[model samples]
Target: MPPNINNTTQLAQNSDKMAAPISPEETLARFEELSVLEAEFEDAELELIRKSTALNEPLWKKRAEIVAKIPHFWTLVLEQIPVELETFIQPTDFQLFANSLQTIEVSRFEIDDPKGSPRSFSIKFGFDDNEYFFNKELEKKFWYRKSKDWAGLVSEPVKIVWKKGKDLTEGLTDAAYDLAQAKKTLAKTSGGKSKAKAEASLPEYKTLASKIEDDTEGAPSFFTWFGFVSSYRWISAEESEEADKEEKTRLEKLKRGEKLDDDEDEDDEDDDADYQETEVFPQGDECATLLAEDVWPSALRYFKQAHEADDEELSEIDVDDMDQDDSDGEIDIRGLVSKGRTSSTSPPSKKQRKA
Candidate 1:
């Protein structure tokens, strides 16, 4: 038969066989080492995020600048020349406008009730050099409502073909090529150098993504509800799987007595616990009383002894009168001898006889 599982009392009696507990100083030193490692890991993670954001900023800014120049190109075609001379105007006129455009203003309006549709609402925004196009001061009149109604109409609308830009298209192509080359160069550099390069090229304007495609028509605004361009740091499933495989291989190698780096050993050691800690109720609640007549007699006895000890301390006079006096606080020598003699039914010993 298997050896009996000892109760808390037996374990306490035999506790001398167990190893001595670790010193408080050693425990504190280990905790401090872990804290330093945690801080370093956090700093490294933060730096990665900062680098990715820096690289993505310039790409978005250049795109915004390109979108901003679009207004002037159309302005030259429809407004600068007479209507009769519209057909004679070459595509080069737009190219010049696009190339020369340094800056432009864009306005937005929310119309609660636009003409031809009072029940419905609409949002209108785009680049228009002349304020007269949006009813001169319609933005001001509907400022409280944040709506610019059709009452602000001041000029005839002009048609713009979004398809062709001649030399401006070539310029965009060159800019894209240059940006791509710069990105490739940055990618080649290790760590912080790449971030520095990207930060240097960042534009002054806040860059927002328009996700504009050449196919998009009748969209005069540089802004769109589509989305924005940003950088992300994430691990793919394949990469995660690879990392797990690497860890398993390193552990196997270590188990086979192969020399491995200190980091690998530390990682493996961290995965294990120095002790198995658990909470157990030796004597369960009232519900357990129906399961067994004496569900945990030993635990009940232990607790009873503890409670009696407390009672004895509180009622020291009542206990001491029946006990013997001693220099020790808890040694009830006379009480113990009397109880033993009463239970044994044997003849008194020399010590008892003398007492």
Candidate 2:
């Protein structure tokens, strides 16, 4: 009876030990569950964005009407843009914007599209008859997309159609546009072969590559963003949907405790490595995001900041002028009177009082 009791106690201890440790597969399954919850949270965030966009539309239109009456409204707002965006704006670019950039508008172009994301937005720059471009309005659309290798907002290069001798981007936009178009042509001609294999065959690619290499300018103009493509390569809607399906299948397998092929990750890495390098406006997405999220919604705040900056500059100039006056032996009677009042023990002389 004592031996039997000890065996049962040992079995109970073994059971406790086994139950205390979780298998790697089980841990991975739990992580996948958390991922699903995170995806749900993202969906909720998108819904909130859609709701807020609807609410803000009327206010934006009203603000636009009021802003139209204010001279250099867009210019002031842009001037007070965050330093992150300021880096891209060259002196020439600012001058152009100040002269011609009348109105800036942002719209969630895909807000109502069931197939499209609310995150997808279009930035429209309304210009007065400018020497730089013929177009009264230049609009750039960014699509929120996902691919097997990368995911974010992707945009095709916009043709600026620059006026003669007034090209701010120094032919960078033209070159970028040409290069993108050439790639598309080549891709179709070469039966979707690797771009690298056919890149040398395209004169447009060489021209852009030469331009990029010859560029001594530390940072390209903000206008170059008009020709902005993806930070990675451009992924079309169809490709994005296919990638989404593939990812869903992968995740489903992960949830089912299936071992994923190591080669799958390697293939993804290879795809990333194949991304075309664009030195021209590599931070385009970031700049676009800043314009859409920060600059657009808070234009009034930025306009106020611009005014505040002007006030600060004026105050600084006043102080400097006062210092200069003092250096030149000029006396301020008001300051003298104030000092006299503060130090009641010392009475002003008749000569000082008169002054």
Candidate 3:
């Protein structure tokens, strides 16, 4: 009855049920995290981009100039955005220390338990101010394991990710005031703002919503997630803006019911096609800028798709008859390892025989 929602995109999304589910809080956090962590990610992504632009900056003098652009970019960004209070050179407890200042050192070492997609790294780095030397490992976050390999002098790029975080609380002090003022303005004008006063007080760390109370849904909702056609329209509008202005000047002919030119119609169709292509993957690159908005309605834009898929899978699973082996707790998972257990009856292997 719903007009047969079976389409290529719907089929694709259904097939991609394995994608991870993301929460509204997490989405809001990610958007904020991007802003908060942008300096680091941008520096990182730019280093990669600059490495691509190496030939553009062929000479050492130019290389230094190009490389110098990095810190300068940050300086410009901080100045324009008024978001960052200050920055300093320090490693986050979670970030790799590259006093060595060369990411090349990181690429040289092997991860401890190397697997299929072995992500190796090095440890030595050198900078004008200092050099960092490390042994053994670095750290791990989520699925990526960070490990330090062999130490060396400053021979290569350090793959340094300054893990340091900012006291967004300080930088956002003004933002909080502005947002609060906006709320008061909205309250007096809309009368709806005070209804959720307690929630309005709830904080949104990475999003404008954080400045507001959580009583309201803010920008996150389910309708937003499944509804991404707006993104396609946005991209189409973007590519058409400049041309649209010019076309408006030529509108007298069009308004007279004059025949449209083949070129103009084709160009319009092309713009529409580009937008359509962009719509295929809402979470792809086109939507990246959307993450920079004041409020990124997380639940509407993202969900832990994988977790939802897993739950869907588990629902179809007929494990109801299965009984837990443990008399207490969920299950004594150790029971499954009985054959590998070190009991008095079984002798240890040669590897452990020495022990």
Candidate 4:
């Protein structure tokens, strides 16, 4: 009787030993599941990246288009700017704006209208050797009806005047208008009296723009008549006071033996290069979110997950681990499964080191 009992005990032990830990196929299946999750994440990240790139393109295009118009604006404002422009113009400035405009190839012109004289928002033209300008809401008249589908037609043609054109005067407004919203931004950065002065001169600047234009083009629109107008304003009395030291030093240099060549003598390099107004499509919050903030992390996460899954890192736990006696005597199916993945019999890098 004792021998039979021992034999029965031994048989039970053998049976327990024979029970499988986990099948190789099940482990592979878990890895495949991880791969799938990673794949989905990867696809989402890639799509998001594409969307981000698309988002920035429009802004770049807008900026490029608007920058193209800078020369026309600078020409209009050259003589009128209260402070003389800095004479130095390196190639970098041209590359930044005017050069870029020639690439977009948009048709542009200005004309005169009754809404106002060649000021504020009207247009003008030149006949023999004279230039013209104007101040008018320039609207691109699109002939969408030519496309042959009534539903296909866009409701409004592409039209642009100045930025928020309402809060401006006739003579000074064109400077602000031609620059789009840059003068406001510049004034804000400059602050106090300078800002006030810029605000004051907006009407006169606008009037100035309405007068001059690039005469090569045909009859211009009230909007196009103003080739372009710079929003740069005078150095205030305070600014002149502040520059006294620098001017004194320059004068001393001249007295000592420096020859001062006047600007009028130099063939001015219409240095319209570095001037950037609000017209340029600028990347700030929206662009940063799409390009750097949103897509790459998601992509990297998915890529790393796929790599770990491919290496069979989740194969350490088996069914017996799930079946192990619990402290509370409760069956914990969740203990057997890990994040809904349960088939691995091998180990991850962290677990392998311990093994």
* Between candidates 2 and 4, the lDDT winner: 2
Better of 1 and 2 by TM-score: 2
Off by over 4 Å in 2: 1-23, 193-196, 251-274, 311-355
Assess each prediction's global lDDT (C-alpha) against the native. 0.29, 0.72, 0.28, 0.30
Candidate 3, residues 1-355: lDDT per residue as tens digits? 1121111111222225677666554454344333334335534763563353343324424434543433222112211221121121111200212112221111213222332112222222223332222222222111112111111111111122222342312222334334444544554665332233432443431343333233232222111111122232222122334443444433444345444342343322323233222122233222222222211222111223322332344324333212233322222111221223233433323242233
- Give a tens-digit lDDT track for model 1, residues 318-339: 3333323343223342232123
Candidate 2 lDDT over 1-355, as tens digits, reads 0021111211222236457756554555555666556566778999999999989999999999999998778888887777888887776566577567889999999988876789899999999987788988899999988876567888988888899998888999998888888877777777544546566557887787778778875667789899888877677787778777876676676567676553354443335333455546777888999999999999999988765554444323222222223422223322221222232233323231233
Between prediction 1 and prediction 2, which has the larger lDDT? 2
lDDT of 4 at 300: 32
Flag clash pairs in model 2: none
Residue-level error in angstroms, candidate 3, position 157: 20
Q: After superposing candidate 3, which stretches have Cα over 4 Å from the reference?
A: 1-242, 250-252, 264-286, 289-355
Cα error of candidate 1 at position 17, Å = 11
Better of 1 and 4 by TM-score: 4
Q: Worst ten-residue run, lDDT, model 3?
A: 149-158
Tens-digit per-residue lDDT, 1-355, candidate 4: 0121111111212225666455554454444444345545644864664565456547645654664554332222111212111111112222222211122211111112221111111111111111121222232211111110011111111223333533112223344344445444566666453354454355544343344322223322222212232222223323433343443444454445454332332232223422223211112212222222332223234334434443453343243353244443223222232334444444455433343
Estimate the TM-score for candidate 3.
0.15
Worst 10 residues of 1 by lDDT: 274-283
